[model samples]
Target chain A: MRTAVKKQYKVAVLAGDGIGPEVMAEAEKVLQVVADKFQFGLTLTPALVGGAAIDASGEPLPAATLALCQQSDAILFGSVGGPKWTGLAPDKQPERGSLLPLRKTFDLFCNLRPGQIYPAFAELSPLHPRVSSQGMDVLCVRELTGGIYFGEKGRTDTDAFDTQRYSVAEIERIARVAFDAASKRSNKVTSIDKANVLQTSILWRETVERVAKDYPGVTLEHMYIDNAAMQLIRSPQQFDVLLCDNLFGDILSDEIAAIAGSLGLLPSASLNGNGFGLYEPAGGSAPDIAGKGIANPIAQILSAALMLRYSFGEEDAARAIEQAVQQCLAQHIVTRDINPNSTYGTAAVGAAIVATLRQENR
Target chain B: MRTAVKKQYKVAVLAGDGIGPEVMAEAEKVLQVVADKFQFGLTLTPALVGGAAIDASGEPLPAATLALCQQSDAILFGSVGGPKWTGLAPDKQPERGSLLPLRKTFDLFCNLRPGQIYPAFAELSPLHPRVSSQGMDVLCVRELTGGIYFGEKGRTDTDAFDTQRYSVAEIERIARVAFDAASKRSNKVTSIDKANVLQTSILWRETVERVAKDYPGVTLEHMYIDNAAMQLIRSPQQFDVLLCDNLFGDILSDEIAAIAGSLGLLPSASLNGNGFGLYEPAGGSAPDIAGKGIANPIAQILSAALMLRYSFGEEDAARAIEQAVQQCLAQHIVTRDINPNSTYGTAAVGAAIVATLRQENR
Candidate 1:
């Protein structure tokens, strides 16, 4: 750690609830292995969140945890909520109480939900064999902080209303986020909206078009949300980066996850105006499998890879982790979630990935 | 000259534009055959609408077309619009000027978009053979007259906003429509909304819960819109009826169609509180194949079947028409759209369907 060649980074690891802690532990093991191999020093601070935080401190996102996260270079978030948190008020739920609040506090504006089916598991797809053979990698770059989710809502005597509002400045920033993402990947972005019907969508399309002039390296296309919904299944491989508002993003992101068939293989990143982010697996805590040690940990380990690339600018370390995951998947050293009869435990899969990294170094 | 025991019904036919006239002709031929076989008298009235109306009377939905529809028992509508009417202002477009006005005039509050994969052509599905072989038949009963589509929307200096409001009464009626449809099918209804996020959706869920008590014979379940989106592909056969708001319907209905592969096999109906309705094919006018006599007439013919069942109370007649269309598909008597290498034209397909009816009668 004292060597001039070594770089040090702090990560706030909030293992929220249920299977979250188990998955987080395995992810940390991978992070440690990569840190040693890449000559990087990692200092991880464990924090309680969601139901765990509620049990210990009577708050979902405790002040201590938030304080720790504010000082950290990155966040490695595990899934939150379980049957134990079911009786809480809607706002007090793990999602509304901790996740949304964390994103809001950090001013996270862009949510990247990337769904890619690893070639070894293409047969697991719900789509036709011929369709799955084409392969699919769609990154839904969603504007998280604005649009209807943050708009004003109210009730009247006979009616209840929620407003869907968007501003030019808000739209421009999200558009730039999407274009930059496209440049790094497929160099294509499909901007989704209901422009033919809604005024917000019309403005969204217009604003995205104006912002496209800055990114001459990326190609731009427009699709109605309705058609985009159908095209996701009809030809999911045709998509690259699907830029959407909060509501559409929530729906389409989940749709893409189901299309991939292997939910455990997916990871997500929420980025602020700067490149800093909270990286997490795009799945929920499995209360049913909690403490059983059989829950899938690959998504969690992949989230750590995303944190390296996006937060620490450790691209080499990120690729090493990602390639190790592909190696484990190819060898079928996965947890029961990916294969019903899989004998590997959460720890075993994690150890396999780290061993792969060591083997590659040899 | 008239048989006193025979019943008669007036049908106003609007063969709108492009492939509309060709498909409408085949549908009428089937109607003529069914009327003769069922001992029912038929009176068909032709009216101009869409681009054809625009060319004839300088309006998309002319007074003459409106007058004809008002006097008819049921309206059999074909596809509409083409390149010829592309220069008009937004409001004067064929869809906004004609179809919307007709729906508004008729007080059509409920839209039924039923998607069923033709049994013989299940291989055409984009879903995995294992997934599609489950045989999906989901009916999306949508509230057409209310919700955000009809709510107040405006733009200000810094923002553009749309209001999504729902009254209890509006939710109850649409819920009832879904439950009734479910009762006739698999006896299950999945009400979809973003209740946790939108206040309108909260009220919607509450109102639907209140209405479910009246439908004692039907099973009711609630799902957030995002989960429902994933479930549609993850396990499509699980759904019986999907009751949604206008915007959700606009997205999910199209999604269900894509699941089934060919849009030509679907038909839709828009009805007011009463049973009177306007029936139409689910696909759009194919200007590319227009006047080539090769457009698929099955959807247009099925629209007539929907008219018989929903509007005229001719259930047996409707089933006969439906079965006949199925036979046509089974026998490979389909248009080029359904089977590109086929020699079957618009007229040949119609004649083939009529021959099946005659054979079934024999």
Candidate 2:
């Protein structure tokens, strides 16, 4: 009899600084549980980044680490930058030195942030129960590399200017990501822009509308940026996927995160055209809580879930991990961030999630 | 003893269309009560505008109406536009033809929208009790004629662009409005911009900081626009005055209004350099409820109060009107939009507020 091998994925893991290594350990453990249950091969290569890399090699991102990332299928990033690296030149700081370079080098043009107010924890939301009770699951798909953020900017003695520019191809790709994500969820998308005022928005609207034809199953809706900001707070449950340009996305994503309540539970992904991605928690590395075994691991574990869903195409495994996290949260087996009354530590919460996933597999 | 002439204000009242006339009538009634209590001479001139002007003279903004507004100290505007004017061309539409022309003609570069969630009606807020119970009072001071909205824009076959340009003069004028408003309220102003990446934002921040020197009593804080959006939802009460360029203001003002709950209770002001202004409700002409007596008149009443405060510099009169409205809301003497169970109509609500004002004076 011939020996059979399970399919494998190599992910470069950058456990950057502070509580990163600790939370990442929990996410890795959860990934191991899912990989075993789903019968898939998983190889996670750990590499130094941020303050850790700086301490070891006098740089935030080591050449060896970048080479390793280049060889991997995807990057699993923990949070970066802490007070320890704040003494360095602004550009030499961990976040600026490491993450910016990685994103630029990889040409990561799309950013997807998943913001959700779990019904079990709806009380955490800033919105009233009438609105929060329905819960909100909005994925903000933002075009990262284009728009005013990366456009031509100049200043004179008397005035200053920043250009918001978008190409048809740029809008189309981000729209596809939104439609794809929407198709997997509620099959609806709300494309936000100021079409009545800006020429870029007019082009964005036209391109997004054209992209809708390709995804026949997914419905598309257009909303002005101002109205979208209001609607997100007034009725967040009405939105499934929100597509935005760089500047608008930067605003709305933070707004969504605010309404979602706990930053510890949000995960983000940045990707390129080739489907290669870097996944991480939207929350920062809490230097204050580092080495205390009390940091929330849900964001990291969810980032791993996103990695499985987007990078590896392991939908079943991804959902299983998501359900496990939800179950753990619903059961009140969460870290202090989610519930101050809960005495659970990072390892305990991770174990509870793993146990839930294993129980579901059986 | 010689008879003294009271300080008089010339106001052009443009009750445009639909419920505009009815709401304007109630607002005028409230204004009359305040004028009598405060002992100020008030000269009110009636003028045609919007659909009413179009019906009378085949133009949304009649030349006679413009001349009347120019001659007055301020314009007391009722809501404009209705389904009746939908057949007109986009440029000839009631809203575009009237308000845009008026704003442009007067060089109304500053827009002040006051969004507040009264403590009595906290339940109407989209925010949780923990957030809304404290009540929110944020004045959004926006640069009306600068930034991306009025910037150069164009489209090509492959791409499109919008230039967000800001001059020192533009930023200074808007910042003055914010600082002056803050000096009247909490003496704190949060300037919103994207200074990290955009050159225009850098100029905006620099200009605002320079302007702050003139108002040493007022404290100044700078926040990135994205963080401002998040902060607005997270802790709206922490804000007193929010200063923004055109685009940021457009988005934040709507968000503020949404969180404030009842749009029928909000008021707005657009002013030029000379203290001349156009005061209006931050809502529409509700054609469906035009002839019905059920239309809420608080917004229009509040607009009159803003006119007294900004245009005529009658701060005491303004505060009196505001207090009367608040008393009516606290007593549940409101229209259907605010309280469905309340039986008060437009005229009745106006009468109740006037009664409250008269009672206070007695």
Worst 10 residues of 2 chain B by lDDT: B2-11
TM-scores for candidates 1 onward, in order: 0.95, 0.99
lDDT of 1 by residue, B36-121 (tens): 88878889999999988888889999998999999988788997888888899966888779888989899888899888766788
True contacts kept of 1: 0.90
Question: Which parts of model 1 are misplaced by more than 4 Å?
Answer: A1-6, A88-95, B1-6
Q: C-alpha displacement of B262 in model 2, angstroms?
A: 0.6
- lDDT by residue for model 2 (A165-232), tens: 99999999999889988988999999999999999999999999999999999989999999999999
Q: Model 1: clashing residue pairs? A: none
Best by DockQ: 2
Q: Residue pairs in steric clash, candidate 2?
A: none
Q: Let me know the DockQ for model 2.
A: 0.94
Please count the clashing residue pairs in each candidate, in the order shown. Answer: 0, 0
Question: Mind giving the per-residue lDDT tens digits that candidate 2 earns over B1-362?
Answer: 98778998899999999899999999988888888999998988999999998998999999999999989999999988998899999988999999999999999999999999998999889999999998899999999998898889999988999999999988999999999999989999999999999999999999999999999999999999999999989899999999999999999999999999999999999999889999999999999999899999999999999999988889999999999899889988989998889889999998999889889998
**What is the DockQ of the complex in model 1?**
0.81
**Candidate DockQ scores, in order:** 0.81, 0.94
